[model samples]
Target: MIIPFIIIALISLMIHVMEPVKEIVLDRLNGKITYPKTFIDKEHRTIEFDSLHVYRTLTTSGDFAITGKKIFIKDRKFNYTWTLKSNECLEYWSFMVWYMDKNRPLPLGTAFNEYRLQDFERRKAEGFSKPLFPGTFHTPERTPSQHRQRKEIGGW
Candidate 1:
């Protein structure tokens, strides 16, 4: 009887842990959940996240530069840095969609357009700018500084 109870307990524990894991697997399979792929454009000072349904971009200065199919900056700034929440990015995309087209669906890569330029100009006129430390967003891999320092010490 004790051995049977121990077996049952192990099975119960496994089920409990695997329930969530199974749900996650199903969600991923159904496209209900997605992993984000981040792209950093050091020359443009922009970071982009592509999470299947939604695409987002921000300047190093924390400005919501682009989200989904909308652009928030008329002219790109290379010397800015900041962080933003995913929800904030989604909200910006929704707002731009509503503002641009109420009835039509936003096309892929819709963020690159004259309308975005106009919107960015309007926002700039309203003086909406957030500046943060450039070092706030660092690449996961080795940076130029690391390379430069190592090179200086002849420690390739």
Candidate 2:
């Protein structure tokens, strides 16, 4: 009985700790930026790039609320809207817009940087790399000053 209780407790703790890892995995799997003829979501639903719509609204706190919608063309037509209400929303939205634009490179801070640490670090080092749109998003990585110092010291 005690052994079972201990196992349950450990499982619960592991689940709690794995929450962020699970989210990251889902984001990576679902948020892939591609300009294929058709876009496939994590739910296995498919929609054309031209048919998809991306919208941005202002939140009460003056931040942005980016949302996307698509109309399915199956026997039963339906509308699917997706809103990423997480810290990675900015990056995801950037990728989405870039994909829609056929993968043309957007401005440094306006783009997702394609998971390149150097681009991210350079953006931080330069500082003031604000997004073209207004949003209250944050990437909780190394400090701007630290990155700037690293750049000054010939670090990549």
Candidate 3:
């Protein structure tokens, strides 16, 4: 009857009103200043020999803590451990590596951007972790105003 419709519509409205906003505030109080863009240092990077065939050319600026001597690359098509050290990696930025299926350098996959911390009790409840290989990385030179804010301790 009309009564059911009215109840349903009212319930739907209430639910919509209670739903969270489109943007969640990441309250990071730390005064950390990251680069305006995400750029990898190609000059100080090296790809492991026979590192990738379907996916060739891996580069880094040495920022990860590779205690296992190297990284372990595993994907739907390729799998290999890396021997990169923190000293050899990039300094300030975190990294995301992904595998490609061709004999050339493909863009980072979904993992690079689909990073989400499962825990809610952590310091920051918002923002996702960087994917291993993002489909593409943005740089200050590439897109200017897209990313010009200083990232805080919580999220950037």
Reference-based lDDT, each prediction: 0.34, 0.42, 0.30
- Where does candidate 1 stray beyond 4 Å? 21-156
Where is model 2 more than 4 Å wrong at Cα? 1-43, 59-77, 88-91, 103-156
Question: For candidate 3, what is the TM-score?
Answer: 0.21
Ranking by lDDT: 2, 1, 3
Clash count of each predicted structure: 7, 0, 18
TM-score of each: 0.16, 0.28, 0.21
Candidates 2 and 3 compared: the better one by lDDT is 2
Q: What order do candidates take by TM-score, descending?
A: 2, 3, 1
lDDT of 2 by residue, 1-156 (tens): 699999999999986765432121111223332221223333334444444456654344335443433222221123545445655665676554443332122334524556546544555455534333333433333447644654455343
Looking at model 2, which ten-residue stretch has the lowest summed lDDT?
21-30
True-vs-predicted CA distance for residue 142, candidate 1, Å = 44
Residues 1-156, candidate 3, lDDT per residue (tens digit)? 799999999999987776543321111222111111112222222233223333223444568533322333222222322332344343111232212211112223444243212221121233323322344444221122322221232233
Indicate the TM-score of model 1: 0.16
lDDT of 1 at 81: 27
